[model samples]
Target: MNASPQFRVLRSRATETHNNLREEILAALESIIFESYHNSFTIRADLEVAFAAEVQSKFAVAAHSGTMSLFLALRACDIGPGDEVITVANSDISTTGAISQCGAIPVLCDVLANDYTINTDLVERSITDKTRAIMPVDMHGHPANVKALRPLADHYNLRIVEDAALAAGACDYGLPVGAFADVTVFSFSPFKPLGSSGNGAMLVTNDEEICDKLRLLVGYGHDPLRHGVKDGYQNYTAEGYNVPLDALEAAVLSVKLPYLKEWTAKRRAIVAALQDGLAGAPARLPSFRPESAPTFRSYMICVDRQFEIYQGLRAAGIEAAFSYAPPIYQYSVYAGAFPNSNELKVTDRLAKELVNLPITPEFSDSDVEYMIETTKDLLEKT
Candidate 1:
């Protein structure tokens, strides 16, 4: 017998918080059933409060999904058609989806060779009079050099709506990822670092005007009236999305919120070990920026013969995988809907070469060692 446990990437489960998530959810249901003051919406409000406090942001808008938050953020910044939003291609289609949703064009940029983040230099040059925003994804929980993008954005009179979907609780320059951008979005999908029971997301910002618009837009434009109401239930002032955070999900996330930092610390420790084990190997580890602290939602490596290695990992009962397989622009669904200048050489190469390693907080020491050894063994054979 091998006597080693399987190392699968992204086998996420519920947070093992001492508090009962079930009870919190039931309390929310009770509020709804009993018709308490402010109704069950209090649960959603509480969750937003906890998340905002955790990230140290003045305002937080509970959203249905990370993509919806992005959509809202784009509108909050007044980015619309005929406007261009610069972003990298090596991310989920949702990164570009937000831009398209706002009737704006997503100008794809390349990424860094070492770290796999947005190539700030290329992003700077891509800016033009039509450029409205820069949406940089903190890929693999690593904060893209966002601080560098801020100065560049200021110079160009552009806005920044960060894709922080994978970077919950991540920090850069002594602050969380959401702290630096004009509006930052996060996901609480079951698999991310800080997750909810079901799908949930948030948009955090310090700007009151953006905050007001986000709240209204998520609720079908109720706050700032732009039009009229339907029936007697839902209303809308401006044409907006019905992307509210459900009460049950909010309750579940609220219970799990307190333990996020501890969980993040555990994940960071595992990443440190992986870095040590893979030192001077054929593979390249995470390309973390200086003074930035990222929660390891997942670990990635740049290696050769990516598919062969992926097959080897799968054959060994490892659940290793890669992302975007098509790097957004190349996705069959988009199929030339977005424009690219072939400057994404790094992004294109990484899409084919990078692999995500199993390194969740759920992983055990044995799991970590097994993955390290398995990877080394596979590399040797390759």
Candidate 2:
């Protein structure tokens, strides 16, 4: 009998993306280094324009990271101390941390068991007089039902600062994930769907006034029309931080940007295969509403043996893990911090059962099959 052939390692990492785009990245960098004599701001400005158009937004400002983008978004909305921002607990610390950093309270909200996004129905009850904004996260590239919450937000006069860190290519309500938001932020971290070489984010908004505020905050609080005309004197608009996106990352991202739609389609195809392959498996797969067209940052499933399956996948050279588990409120830093933590029943349950499977555009059919077979085997036995 012939021996069985060994398959390639099934892992999702930014290195794979960078490796695939290495030549393009290098060429982009070379052009920036030798061909152009402009400052970092010039390339960054170009990226901002291109990215804004890609997402169908009127204006965009690239920032150092998604965290910075969120902070800037809230700041642009004038969120401050004693204000409250309603958001989900089953997300990266960045979601709530941005609100907290702005001296605003992060009011915890439960997520839906199916899509693992905020439960819009519960949002109104959480609203209080102090609430200034609603920051809904598109968890695991699943679009939060922001459209449903739009009326509630409008009624309360609250700003919608969407945290779409992992949802770079996802869409909802017949538009991009950020279309319904006052300000939407997309992350370009190494592990994100639209992975860049390093950390970067873009804040997009239709409101020019909000765009102006975001630019003022990212650009050292300098209003070009108001200050620095005298050459020696520079006036500040608002106390802001210098957190603009790096020019090199912008250049790399620009090369990758045009391919986003194609890449997103690839991600969706892989997930469809996984869903079909795992239909009989013990794990409960994620489900989205009909209108939501989510791009896979990572495919998540709820399983009883979360750790066992996670460890098994790792031992078998498949990268699987629990992301955003333990809920943010359960973190040591947030212990006793959120009074409403106990109300996040669904979020609490998801933290225990959710397992993220590696999904990337670089994944071949064999990689997808191996992962599916390995996970099903693990689920069957464990």
Candidate 3:
């Protein structure tokens, strides 16, 4: 059997980029190791500046990870035990975990079949007296229907915390993803659209009060006046947690932030090529609207016999797998907890059919073509 061209070409280029990025990371480590900072404030300020420039927000807070970012944002908004947060079940488990950590109930909602984002009508219907917030995840670098969601939130007096972990450069109409929500959380994990060598995360908000509260919550609730404490006896104002991003990781993330726009363009180009090549294939390509621009963090498709296709791609030396199979609600931890867990029809269908293909910046035109051809062949032959 002849190996697919994607196996021979795509993997090599991705490995090359990985090696080069590792060297650049080492050089950054060497530089930061010698720099002297007067206090932790300096590092925080640098991150704030970098984030503010990228998201066009006045306030940004650095967190230990994307999960923590969501937790802090929820906490700052006063969402705690007994509160219900409406969100989709077709997202990474991190979002659900964060909600549970804050002692809030996660109300699982179904996603649209076309875009794979939370259904706005379902979200509106899920609201109740206990509903305090709605967390819409931007799945696969595409923004959810935040414009419609904003109005619904205002109607119900609910807070909107956008999980934009996959959407670094994603924009809807003319507005960026972060600009539409009350609070937006972004991830800097190794697999995100704009990732660091290690874990880091950011929270962006235009609300000063929320930003101030989040800062205090992440910094042990220490009053600014107690910056210089004597004899290790400092007064703590409120209960909080230690969730600060490492300075070294922040430095590396700052380096990659500048190239995000170019990288996003490349991903879109590749998705377009794949769509065109597989126009008549049996597999279903992602459905993106004309008004939105997705960063294409992962090129995903839904099809029958998804498991067979997954194994076929692997045998062909193409790394493909289910993105979020066995939806979050099906996990043992959330088995009977989430409300409406039994009614997630679309979510259940997607969990069984979604397959994520490699769509990194390193993939070439031939790599995309081979993916389309191989996928078609597998679907037909099976």
Cα lDDT listed for each candidate = 0.81, 0.87, 0.81
TM per candidate comes to 0.90, 0.94, 0.91
Give lDDT for model 3. 0.81
lDDT value for model 1: 0.81
Give the candidate order by descending TM-score. Answer: 2, 3, 1
After TM-score superposition, the amount by which residue 12's alpha carbon in candidate 2 deviates from its true location, in angstroms, is 3.2
> Could you give candidate 3's per-residue lDDT for residues 201-225 as a string of tens digits?
8999999888888888888886463
Model 3 misplaced regions, further than 4 Å: 1-15, 18-27, 37-44, 223-233, 340-342
Q: Model 2: how large is the Cα RMSD against the reference?
A: 3.9
For candidate 2, lDDT tens digit of each residue in 243-293? 889889998898889999998999999999999999989989999899999
Clashes of each: 2, 0, 0
Which has the higher TM-score value, candidate number 2 or candidate number 3?
Answer: 2
lDDT of 2 at 242: 88
lDDT of 1 by residue, 272-327 (tens): 98899888778877666678898887788888989988888877777787766668
Q: Which residue pairs in candidate 3 have backbone atoms (N, alpha carbon, C) closer than 3 angstroms, thus clashing?
A: none
Model 2 poorest ten-residue lDDT run: 1-10
